[model samples]
Target: MIPTKEEWIKVLNEKHGEDVQKKLSAATVAICGLGGLGSNIAVSLTRAGIGKLILIDFDRVDISNLQRQQYRMDQIGEYKTSALSENLTLINPYTELCVHTVRVTEDNMEELLREADIVCEAFDKAEAKAMLTNYVLENMPDKYLVAGSGMAGFDSANLVKTRRVTKRFYLCGDGVSDVNDNIGLVSSRVMLCAAHEAHAIIRIIAGKYEI
Candidate 1:
């Protein structure tokens, strides 16, 4: 049986101190692109008890996504925003979710992410990644952005590290590997990068910003 909301919050308070839990529980995060990286990042943040999540994606789950994404085989044709929200609700019923089944473009980016304290960029294409990164850095100056760079292939897991790009911009991944280089993405490595993004956001929420 699912735990009561009070019971769940108490557990999170024990794991994270009361002050930290309060901050985490008050933060809103927006995840752009619900693919391997975004899916895993959302799971981590939800499990950490984030208060609200804005999930944006324009794609449907495909059979190929099962290798690294968080969707189930039964959800293959479902829109990623819908599927991920369903899964996250099952994981943490207390977390509020606002999903948009539309692509995030230059025009709608700011409005969609306006309420988020942190924004995570997890798009698959290089152009898309650059587009979101540039838009966030240029337009949304106050929001913290955590982006994935090079999590493709089976490289040393240690290579997947998080770096603080600017005061509010951070990046996770190896900075070298690419899927177009003939090396495909491995589940473990991609998830590792996702974890970095998630952890960075948690640390930011908890007021720990060293790495």
Candidate 2:
């Protein structure tokens, strides 16, 4: 049964308290990638009543992505941004979404992310993660950045963690795990790290973080 928009808002306010819900509803988060981590994080924030989301990705949903991505089988061959936006609207129709179908580059990064209250690093590639991290910290020093690293495999859920790297930077994940031969990203661990990034965004917006 699809709940009415007011019904969804009421549920969110009751669960998060009016003040936190308001904060969440006023924040805009920009997510760099729409793979395992970004997809999960986007769903979480949407369910939490985030006002707007900016999603960027150049890839489409593939069969191999079913293992950890939030996409359904029917979404195969669809762009990740489009698939995620469709799913997010189902979760919260009132939410606003801005999608970029192009790959993030140094030339366009600042313009793409300038309006966001928080920037989330959700790329699967290590180099992409590092590049986005450096660019955001250097150019958009005022924006809060929540990023994940080292979240791969199914070894230990507790290994996924969150830490405040700086006043405006937060890092999530094991900080050492990576996808490689014999080790791959499973939904459990990937979602765990994604949850940390989502929570960090909430904390920063809700004034629940110390740094």
Candidate 3:
């Protein structure tokens, strides 16, 4: 098993600088949806040396998703969780990851939270986020949950902001909206929100950034 702190930083410092290695190697994050936003978040976190990662996504890759998601055309039809988990392990062999290829629901919320130190909500559906948030607020008040909103267009840069949606939950995405119902996202907007989600997780772990 990889040591959560010292050993991780000692090896990771060669890839990330000292501060990033220290901050990220101490953190465990869940990228709950391996879609456009979740893909970016997981990639950045692995690169940053986040100690443990949890990937939860029931969806399969589609050609449409490849335009914004980090996965390649060859990965189509693969489960998002499995592909992302596989890639993350390849990126950093020492970093631990759990892959859950099931949708998050009130029924399995407890099961999902059991292994994670904090949760990240990358679901695109409003109902899923609401259910996940409600479950956390009612049953797991101590855990952290970070989320995103308004990231689907070229103007997504203007939308990425970090703010507390609740006491222990954070919202990271465009505060403003340019994502129409039919709008599509570029890699930039999706990745911007994703990076903010990774940063929030790292900050929470380092006792610096608060939800």
Candidate 4:
């Protein structure tokens, strides 16, 4: 039988106090890219009792994504947001969710992010990240994106050394120039970035740090 919200609260409170649970249950977060970083972060957020999750990504799962993405082999070729939404429902049936298969851009930025409490920019494209940063800074000035940078190489791996940019936005993964401009990252480093991104996202959503 499904427990009531009170029961859920009791279970959560056993490990955490009312404040943390309240923060997790009241925030609405939008996760973009649904790839390595976004996928793991979504999973963490769902399990952590985030009241709502807005998953946005137009990409389909590939064999490559399965290694680091929070997806199974059966999810290949499926839209990422849909796959993750379904998984999240199983993880936390109490959590509300919104799924968007469209990519975030200047034209659609405001509409897509209007209701989001915070935005997670997990896309690997430099141009897209720059555009999103400008869009949020212009239209959604109060919001933030826990972005990733300098995560190109599998060798440039270190999760604990990641740094936050502003109170809201952060640059996880290696910040040095050693990150290859063209080399692709492996699962280890990608997941490392995803974990830090998830942590920053949690802290932001909890209102521990403002943008």
Candidate 5:
């Protein structure tokens, strides 16, 4: 059975301390893509008791996504925004979710992410990643951006590290590997990068930014 909201919050408080838990529960995070990295990052944040999430994605789950994404075989063909929201709700019922089954573009990004304290960029394409990163850094300077760079291939897991790019911009991954290199993405390594993004957001919420 699922625990009561109070019971869940109490456990989080015990683990995170009251102040940190409060901050985590009050923050809103926007995940720009709902694929491997975004889905895993969303799961981590939901499990950490984040208050709200704005899930944006324009793709449907495919059989190929089963290798690294969080979608189930039964969820194949479903829009990623919908599928991920369903999964995240199961992990933490108390976390509020606002999903958009649309692609994130410069025109809509500002309005979609206006309420988010942190924005995570998890697009699969380099062009898309650069677009979101440039838009957020130039337009949404106040919000923290955690982006994934190079989590593809069978590279050393230790190579996946998070770095603070600017005061509000942070990046995670090896900074070298790419799927186009034909190495492909491994589940464990991709999740490691996702974990870094999630942990960075949590640390930011806890008021610790010296990464």
Candidate 6:
């Protein structure tokens, strides 16, 4: 059954503790994709009671995305931003979601991520990841960027880990794996990395992130 706004708040506060819930309730996170990583990250963050979310994705849900992304089969063909918003709101009725169904580019990086306390990068392409990483580091210098790099295939979940690239940048996943001819993505491995990215955002917002 779906919880009402007040009931959801009570449950989250009890589960996360009042202090941590407060921190999460005041945070704004911008998720830059809605594939395996971004879709899962958005759900986790919402369940954790994050106050505001800026979801950006220009692509529509596809049949293949059902294997790992946070979309139902009925949602196929709908814009990812729209599909995810519906699901996330169901989890946390009080959470505010700002959707932008547009592609991200270096030219628009600043405008997209300026208000985010933490930027979660979940693009599928390596060059796209690098592009956003560099853009965030250079333009949104103060924003902590949590990105995934190596969660692919059915490799041991232990291999997936988070690494701090710099004071303002962190990479999650095996840090060496990638989806290829042999390696493929599954929900478990992808969600592992997404959890890392989501938790990193929480830590940063709570002022508990450590090098």
lDDT of each: 0.95, 0.92, 0.78, 0.77, 0.93, 0.90
TM-score of every model versus the real structure: 0.99, 0.96, 0.86, 0.88, 0.98, 0.95
Give lDDT tens digits, candidate 4, residues 1-211: 7678788778876765788888888988888789887888898888788888888899998888887788989989888888888888777788899988997878887888888878888886778877887677666778877777655565645433456676556767676423346666677777777777777878876666642
lDDT of 2 by residue, 1-211 (tens): 7888799889989999999898988899999999999999999999888999999999999999999989999999999999999999987888899999999999999899988999999998899999999999998978999999988877789878898888898999999887964587889899999999999999999998874
Candidate 4, residue 57: the lDDT equals: 93
Best by lDDT: 1
Candidate 6 pairs with clashing backbones: none
Of candidate 2, the 10-residue stretch with the lowest lDDT total is: 176-185
What does candidate 5's lDDT look like per residue over 1-211, in tens digits? 9999999999999999999999999999999998889999999999999999999999999999999899999999999989998998888899999999888888999899999999999999999999999999999878999899999999899999999989999999999898999998899999999999999999998999998
Order the candidates by lDDT, highest first — what do you get? 1, 5, 2, 6, 3, 4
Q: Judged by lDDT against the true structure, how good is candidate 5?
A: 0.93
Off by over 4 Å in 4: 1-5, 176-182
**lDDT by residue for model 1 (1-211), tens:** 9999999999999999899999999999999999999999999999999999999999999999999999999999999999999999999999999999898999999789999999999999999999999999999888999999999998899999999989999999999899999999999999999999999999999999989
Cα distance off (Å), candidate 5, residue 121: 0.5
Ranking by TM-score: 1, 5, 2, 6, 4, 3
Question: Candidate 3: lDDT over CA atoms?
Answer: 0.78
Kindly list the per-residue Cα lDDT of model 3 for residues 1-211, writing each as its tens digit. Answer: 5455566567778766677676666667777788877888888778777778878898999998987887878889988887777777777766778888888888887887776778888888766767887788779877888888777766737657899877788988875454556676778888888888888887787677554
Instruction: Point out where model 3 deviates above 4 Å.
Output: 1-8, 14-23, 176-180
- Pairs with steric clashes in candidate 3: 159-174, 160-174
Model 5: weakest 10-residue lDDT segment is 101-110
- Predicted structure 6: lDDT: 0.90
Model 5 deviation from the true structure expressed as Cα RMSD, one decimal place: 0.7
| Residue 163 miss distance in model 3 (angstroms) | 0.7
Question: What ranges in model 1 sit over 4 Å off?
Answer: none
